[model samples]
Target: MKDQGRSPRKRTGGRRRPNHKKKKHELGREPTETQVGDQKLKVVDSRGNTQKVRAVTTDVASVADGAETVEATIENVVENPSNPNYARRNIITKGAIVETSEGEARVTSRPGQDGQVNAVLVE
Candidate 1:
């Protein structure tokens, strides 16, 4: 659910609040795309005169070490506390540990937001 603005419960003095209506800019929404499997992308309209790239499905990740970076195939999502179902569904997100061709890696970038998956190999 989207976060809505409400009046504070711990208020001092007898103050009245004006009736405020929800604005289009203040509207909150959840991301629908869940990246998994092969690579797929979608362009979404944002607040400004720009577009946001959303990854629908992805099978590759750029795994980086100290000074080396390599593109590796994604195996699976290891853990995801943001959403337990995401791990089972293999959805890639920032901070999620994922298995790659190189080895186990921790995702460093938001695939859903960045439209690309980037990870760091873990020891």
Candidate 2:
């Protein structure tokens, strides 16, 4: 598990001893790495009695063109500003340009976190 706590080093570049043990609220998980494929979702328990839906894989996206929103089939990832490797691996994330049935669109939502891909049609 990854730690979401503060750094172990001080601002003065000195090592600081941990004040307490790790807590559940300070835990972190790996990225979902949502891909273009059959729809698959995972529900996870979160803090404050809430739940998070993660998209493991999906093949459809909601593309907004001007004032209209339409569902389109996701073809493949075109480019990803977050990571070049992500584009090559076809991992979908926010701000990624994807080829859809409607046309090329820029992702406007976090698929892994939102459980769906929302995008804006690109000219």
Q: Which of the numbered candidates is closest to the native, going by highest lDDT?
A: 2
lDDT of 2 by residue, 28-48 (tens): 789999999999999988778
Q: What Cα-based lDDT does every candidate model obtain?
A: 0.82, 0.93
In candidate 1, what are the lDDT values of residues 1-123, reduced to their tens digit? 335776544376555564677788778568755566888888888777988788889898999988999999998889886888989888888888898999989988887777888899989
Q: What is the TM-score of each candidate against the true structure?
A: 0.81, 0.86
- On TM-score, the leading prediction is 2
Candidate 2, superposed: residue stretches over 4 Å from native: 1-3, 7-17
Worst 10 residues of 1 by lDDT: 1-10
For every candidate structure, what is the RMSD over all alpha carbons to the true structure, in angstroms?
3.6, 2.7
List of clashing residue pairs for candidate 2? none
Q: Could you tell me the lDDT of residue 59 within candidate 1?
A: 90
